[model samples]
Target: MIPEFWGNGIAANPDNYLDEDEFDSSYEGLLRLSERIGDAKPKGVPEHVIHTLPTKPYLMSKARSPDERCTICLSEYEHNDWLRDLPCAHDFHKECIDSWFKNSDKCPICRRSILENKEL
Candidate 1:
């Protein structure tokens, strides 16, 4: 069997592990890979929903700091960097996670549905 490498370490599958009901992708993981190809919005996570999430510039403080770097970019954030607060309360560099949300709507660390809480 030949394996397909959808650029950037993502792959396609027919095993149905993360089917629509389980993970909400129209074509397993390929839907996300396509978003990378041309910046198109994935079917399930529309731009409107993306806009619904709360985003703001980072404000460093003793209580709230960029202690946690973005899981997507693997770089520490500096003060004044933009941040996106997911419905799960976990935040990430706006640019890093914004690109990420364009592909998938799950929180990077907790895998929570980004739309679970509307109060954000």
Candidate 2:
């Protein structure tokens, strides 16, 4: 008796399907690929959250030193230069911090994550 085809052309009782060993190897490969993808670094925070940070003008009197500078840009803070303040109390130039937040949500000086200890 001739076996019937399963519509798409494979014989009803054909042996093209993977054996136990082959099936195990393919499953293992998928597991390894998923692990690699999961190992990748995560992206930065949302733009709206970054914008929620506060800013203020630099004042030499309240500064750490006369030559106090923004760690992100290495430039000395001038009076009236806007500074963005993180929840960690580490502040940086508005522009510089904004740029940094595009890639990371942590403070450059303390590496403190602004997303921590607060609900947004």
* Predictions in order: lDDT: 0.70, 0.79
Q: Which pairs of residues collide in candidate 2?
A: none
Residues 41-95 of candidate 2 have per-residue lDDT tens digits of 6656677887888889987676368447989899999879999888888888999
Model 1, 1-120: lDDT tens digits are 434555323455456345656654458566776666764544335567777778887666766544557778887766788888887788888777778866686888998877665433
Q: Which parts of model 2 are misplaced by more than 4 Å?
A: 1-41, 62-67, 118-120
lDDT, residue 41, candidate 1 = 44
* lDDT score, candidate 2: 0.79
Which residue pairs of candidate 1 clash? none
Q: Ten-residue segment with the worst summed lDDT in candidate 2? A: 1-10
Off by over 4 Å in 1: 1-44, 62-66, 117-120
